[model samples]
Target: MAEKEWGRLPEPPREVVLRVKRYDPERGRTWWQEYRVPTYRGMTVLDALLWVKENADPSLSMRYSCRMGVCGSCGVVVNGVPRLACQTQIAAVASRENPVVTVEPLHNHPVVRDLVTDFTAFFEKHRRIIPHIVRRDMREVEEAEYEFLMTPDEHLSIYQYSLCIMCGLCYSACPVAASDPEYLGPQALAQAYRFIVDVRDEGYDRRIAIVDTEHGCHRCHFAATCSAVCPKDVDPAAAIQRLRRIVFLRRLGLWRKRKVAPLAGPLEKPLRRIRAEYPRHNLVEGADPERQAREPVDIDFREEWLRE
Candidate 1:
């Protein structure tokens, strides 16, 4: 099979140096390898990496899928910033005169090899937020059901967040994630807000209970880097801020979960369902009653949830 052309041939390709950070778990070693790669007018970082892997070194490793930006698989640190390699043009990071494109694995993630970072923990944090719609009628969810109707205005409200590809770029650029390993990170928190505000979703009480804790949305220090580095232009920092306000209001007994959006039906209107509640555990499980009483579990939210 013929090799596919990488980028536009508007201009002649130039020789650019690609300085890649390499790691070998088998040898437990880390090093840098520089390769001179041919670049074109619209050649991307991923294109250069492919060229290197095919021509210069077959052992060179990196992750990429769907040369387009949809899959979010080619996330890497391009000269100290988390970016989608497929979306980043080579001209943006390198020049013919000073031609050097430094590539490395994302920060705050465990490196698997050369440029691949382990997403096990990152995905685990995402799963803990319960990134799915929660409706009271388990039967409706499990069995066949009518579509949940939503207006254009309602759809537009949460449309931006729906664009998240779970690329982990926000999590990699998050300063809070760098400091606290337990922090839920921006991607998860943004996704939490996405489902919370989604008119079709009814998972507010259940999700809020999970993200209202210290290691959850509260850990975000509002660095805004997560928003800055997002390839899809999703503002996770803004979502975190809004989530914080909602959490505060819920604690102060000022806000309540809104009713679920209506289902498409000509016979009857969708019934309002009671919010699903989950307990917030402040004390360690199996701790002595005396120790639980003596120790101060400093939870920021009030015990208003306990009253219900």
Candidate 2:
């Protein structure tokens, strides 16, 4: 254990001040505690906390798993900005000279302990939206009927919102959520949009009653901060805007739900399925059946579908 025996470590660990906020619910008090953590290259903020818990202070508490960013459990406020602790590099927010990183719990949620916040309310709001595909037919939902199909364009519309990991960083960054807990907030609204426009989902109308309420989509001020802080790159603000537009369009008389051409109709299959099974009508939704009826032998079912 001689100093010289450990020949000048190629990447010497540097000391950084971790100014962590400590809160005790029983005592009803909060305080900042500082620890000097040896930060090396590629070390994350979560790594620093873990190191302190192991070597420095055993009582130091924080919640994390997957050490990778996917679990969404390591969200914390670093230097006044909410971000995932596992993904934030310590050096990126702290330096050798001014090596102080202020770590606190996420803003909006009630703190469970040192760095863990109670996600009950956030999850309740999420659940209130019924974040799932809703089908009108009870038999089809309970048992398999046919494959739920979607075009690539339809997939693209909701895919971005679907990427949300429910990290709550968006909730932390939202001014509305911080001030008014009643608001459905960006996270819930964006997820509602994920199901709303989905071709395979039939629950849009049901969710509309919830999202169009007082503390719902209307309350968002388009601050765009939610999208900015999202770790998943899901643009929640844009989704809310699109949701508002859809509500307004439906209010007026445009944009009715497209008639679903039944699979059991005259054309035993959709033109796209036929083309995929046969050859090229090669297009988005396979060139609307009504628009082209060039040949009487074309096996068109527009007349039948349109009548319904």
Candidate 3:
């Protein structure tokens, strides 16, 4: 018997119109340019652009370092949706009435050439938050006497945020970034939360003021448009909301007192055993109430804070 393949590719009349937005800074002009490229199975938007650049238009330009979605460089607005060019397939964006999927530089950022946009403002916002682990005990942190250890649950808290490639899709999708250049956009805000939740990072006190400002988490209207368009499932809107909760809880003095962050090495407790305890307010007033007498309480911060 002959060996059989599980799948076969579609026959080649797979052609689509790639309408790209172009800009020439020197001539001070911008326009829509179209190209008809023969698509194949697994052909991405980046792949289509490469085929055009190699076969059709050498003048066309875009920035893409890793063809895979690692480097976070090839961010563009496709079909009015912000996404990673290399990750979006031609077949995915193609449709009957609008067979022509549009490609353009990120809307909020200044276009450098054709498909590339300037990241100066994007990176500056990232830097403003001081996105790094900071500890007052310089000796323990800098000398690496011991490593800060975290439970599996603790690590998972911010793991989704660490996946952000800083592709700027969220920033482009945000109406806030476009109108207020000084606003710390969703990408940086998400990153701020990534470290803020980490057991290893002690930078919360240092970073809180930066994110608690008028241009910070307070500015997010919870439209969640940033979360909707993020290629990486980093829920920036949720992060901002959590930041607000942290700040508000602190002001009310209801935040659970955290134990000193644990340090693990050859001689230390296991990570899971090192977790800080939950707030006392969450616990029932009576201990082990008669078999079925106890019921879970619905605790609200506003209500609890006013309680004596």
Candidate 4:
């Protein structure tokens, strides 16, 4: 008995323009170059690029491995937003009027070639955070049988943050890094929070102190670009806010008191006034809050001490 046949798959539409940023070390110049590619039905931006590189121009250079977003190798600035080319659909972004998707290397990093950037600084910052578990005490021989146990609630607290794929999108989109390169940036700061909030880590206080510095959590301005462009929905901005709250509470000894400041102007106004008057009344510097609260702190001494 013969079975009835279903309809065949439809052919992909003919051509799409790939506008790429081209740079050659030998030539010492960079320019945009366009290539018209014969794209398939489910073709992605990465596929189109590969097609152009293989057939149209062998000199063209780009980075890719799995042809998937997992490797984070093909992340580039597409139309001003950092996205993985493999995950971006060509049909959706390419247009006849615009008909060209501008592809450039990831920002805030040294460009190696046409689409690849040097990731040494990015990974170096990650390494500086010391992302690891620190055990408090040696477990006894019998106690060693049980691994560190975490509650469901505790796991839920940091579960979203642990999903970071380190695609460098957050780093590229970060305005803080552009203005102040010393700032730790979102991905690294979020990872710091991941460890600081973990119940199993013994060095939570140390980690908090690490992030409380000028280049750490305090540098974040609460801009939500890191959260918005994150492909995995890991809200680094929210994590940073949590870390800032933790730092603020720790400085004020409110963590033990279990009290959070009200959202109204009572607390914020005084703090802002003190900040304006003192300019250098960071809690870490042993600034006397009572003195500052009573009268404006001397900024000259604070600045001299900070320089020291």
Question: What are the RMSD figures for all models against the true structure?
Answer: 19.1, 13.2, 16.5, 23.6
- Evaluate model 4: give its lDDT: 0.77
Estimate, for each residue in 77-196, the C-alpha lDDT of model 1 and write its tens digit.
Answer: 998889999988887777556678899999999999999999999999899988887787755566636778888988887889889998899999999899899999999999999898
Tens-digit lDDT string for candidate 2 (65-155): 8988888999999999899999887767776568899999999999988998999999999999998767787555567556666667878
**Candidates in descending TM-score order:** 1, 3, 2, 4
Against the true structure, whose lDDT is highest? 1
Alpha-carbon local distance difference test for all models: 0.84, 0.81, 0.81, 0.77
In candidate 4, how many Å is residue 94 off? 1.3
TM-score for each predicted model, relative to the true structure: 0.81, 0.79, 0.80, 0.75
Candidate 3 vs. truth: CA RMSD?
16.5
Model 4 over residues 258-287: C-alpha lDDT tens digits?
222121222222211213355454466667
What is candidate 3's local distance difference test score?
0.81
Runs in model 1 lying further than 4 Å from the true structure: 1-13, 266-308
Q: Higher-TM-score candidate among 1 and 2?
A: 1
